[model samples]
Target chain A: MDKDKFFSNDPRFKVAKKEAWIGVGLVLFNFVWWFAFAYGLGSKSPDEYTYILGFPSWFFYSCIGSLIVMSILVIVVVKYFFKDVPFEEEVQDIQNQSDKKSS
Target chain B: MQEYFLGSRSMGGFILAMTMMATYGSASSFIGGPGIAYSTGLGWVLLSMAQLPAGYFVLMVLGKKFAIVSRRYEAITLNDFLKSRYESQWVGILAAISIIIFLFSSIAAQWVGGARLLESLFNITYPIALTIFAFSVMIYVIIGGFRAVALTDTILGSIMFFGTLILLVAVIIAGGGVTNIMEKLIAIDPGLVMPFGADGNLSASYVSSYWILVGVGVVGLPQIAVRAMSHKNSKSMHHAIIISTVFVGIIMLGMHLIGVFARAINPSIAVADSVMPTITMEVLPPFLAGIVLAAPMAAIMSTVNALLIMVSSAVVKDIYLSYFNPQAPDQKVRSISYLVTAILGVIVYLMALSPPDFLIWLNLFSFGGLEAAFIWPVVLGLYWKRGNKYGAISSMIVGVTSYILFHQFYPNAFGMHTVVLPILLSLVTFVIISIVTEKKELLQAVHK
Candidate 1:
């Protein structure tokens, strides 16, 4: 129930916050690149094009580029973002509240 | 009175029922149905039949354990439940971001579908129709929250059920009967009335993969997942399962079949998405058509509103409250929630303005993305003892990244949906990482 103790002092949460920033970084990167790709090359006709593995050149590049970026974000979150912080006290408090209400 | 959050009691049972139906019955049934039917023919109807068991599958798989765990954690939203169950901030963030991104796209698709339906019916500009549709939803959702959404869904669901039945009758009557329609379809192309879709292009690979996307994978969707946690007990869950299955089956089959049969009656119709509205106007009288058309609009608006609230909640509740400002006042949280929801709606509207070629594909793409991002994290977190933060993080990353990659380059990579590969890959990653990182301290606490 103590907000500061529950969040601020939790070492695991600090790690989680840092990992979230990594995710934020990935989102920002993808957003920018997608905007650029859409504006710069998305307008080109197939006649003015290159190809990759039987697909249009622009489509191929966009697919690979976005996947790489999303992969990086996923890696960061999985490797460094999550923390196993204990919330026993909070769980107990919630349980007590439910029990009281039921009775 | 406060227990309305548990399940509607003060709100009449009829209203509650209506809300449930309306919320669950979506534009996928209305606009997407007729559109698919027109393009693929009777095969599309058979393909749609996979959705009949969706509600039962989700509720049964999740069961009572899911709800108990969610409530035990004081988790109000599906994101909230996932956050607590996994005990992983990364899972929460991934779940939150995926919901925001994909649900925004999904909402935009619905908005476009709603606006187009209105434009056809009322002779209004697309922009005006969109504005009207958006405002009507925003007002009710802002006022009523989930309760309003559920109640409205029940009403909309009833309308959808009856609307499909009535339209089916009308279409059969207008087409001179099922026998005549079948002969006409046969004359044009025998494949049109066949169960494999027009031109035999439906493909076993694609049709079977939809069972994962629309059927089994629906369990992971946050909007639907929250429903499992909302029912009062196992009894309500059982009742809901039966009711939702029958309702979904009737609507999906009826709408898609009507679409396939429309071609026999009006062979000259172009722009497949407009087939439903076109067919409705032709089959029913004007005033009746207006009312009947509202069923699709109802489906669209209900879906849009649910996604809006969900995305906004993810932003306000999961990210902002939990991470950014844990000490913020309640009033501030409330205001921020409202502001974020409105802003998100605007962004989705912009994205939807120039929609992709196939609206259903766009919606399904979002569905696949969310399922991949959240399924392992939520499911494994609940059942597995060794599901640690590291595994949760890894599962989400693998799930979402592979989903995007597969969707882009090789949509049916290895003869399966993009979601299938990612879900499998993530489960492997989760097990590997969880085993490698397991510690006595982390393993000891179950309740925590």
Candidate 2:
């Protein structure tokens, strides 16, 4: 359990950590935001059954409208912010180096 | 085919998108989900949209990190990643068992869906239909493997995409436009036109929880997660996100809308699940109806094959090869893998012979059970470096046990779905156990 060696101010781990938080943060934000807009805005009124595009107002915005918004948002997020982190090769390199040192 | 079954790990954007949609869209989406919507009304359509972002969540959350990490480990299955990451046989074995156990319900749901579809379409007896579907899927899966599954899914996905459009148009025409359909529905019950269902049965709290269950919690499903390990690059993931999102949006809204509309046309349907095939046959010409019918067949076959492969891979690769015979030859592993998959299919077919009430419930139960069991271990194990095997095993145990208990004794506990409580409980258990074990392991490492 040489935990320190793996975690000790390792530049790769640092970058990986930052990337993870940003990714998780963005996903969580979208999950909450989407549900709010889908249900909160769409189903605000209980008694009335409003219609949009011949659909119940809540359904029109919550599903069809929200789906269009979601598609665009997902593409934008992936394009601009997401990075390709090479976790495999980096982890393997460290393991190889350790094996050599131990021998 | 070998690469296809075992993943070539070099799929392009279009193939990746098609495969993801095909695998995710199942008998439930095509037959069972639409059936439920027909009876439940427009409220169910709104709830089904929670699945619109499913592909996005799985691809993005797991993303390049999971693919790269898996390549580094040369891991194939979700349980393979678990075994390597946690460095424990117990964790690996538990994961394999969980996948096999939970996936049965999913596979059986597909079988029943396929049989029901066939029974209606061919006008055959239920037993004959069941046997036909069972044998066809079993033989095709055994022969085609994962490559067969992916190729078929690509074809099936395209059918569903076009089938949805054609059916929606045909159905709208049959019902004398959406306006007339609305009039008929309003005539039956003004409540049918409401957002909260015909009787206001759909609650705000319940709707919100479905967003968690089908939307966010999809990241935990092994069959879906395994797709993360197969793409060529980040570009494929991005493409998958856009294509699948759009396709799912249309398929869900279109199919379910067709369901709600079916009531206005034929309100006296004896069985709700038959509504889809019935409407298709009635609206489209006989020649075209056959093509449209293939979409559900495709959906059922694709879903069952994916589940079968995942279950078999979990058994052969994770447990048998890893434990009993680490040095078993490749040919032997392949043979046993095929055998295990066939046996699983037959078992599910038997279960579907006397189909129980609420077939989709079995599928949803599988979804929640898998989400609870694997969500914490997979997500935290990747993100939180402090996570270890003890935490992984304990998290799985608590997650699975609580989900089952809650499902049986206290479903929709506190108005939210059973999954919400178990996922939160497992998250707490994983972190606490990890922190407590970290120091002791550190001390032991120092002693060593």
lDDT of 1 by residue, B103-177 (tens): 877787787888788878888987888788778777776666666677667777777878888898899999887
Task: Show where candidate 1 strays beyond 4 Å.
Answer: A1-103, B1-21, B439-448
Task: List candidate 2 segments past 4 Å from native.
Answer: A1-48, A84-103, B1-5, B443-448
lDDT of 2 by residue, B238-310 (tens): 7777788788778888888888888888888778678899989989999889988888888888889899888
Please report the candidate that would top DockQ against the real structure: 2
State which docking tier applies to candidate 2.
Answer: acceptable
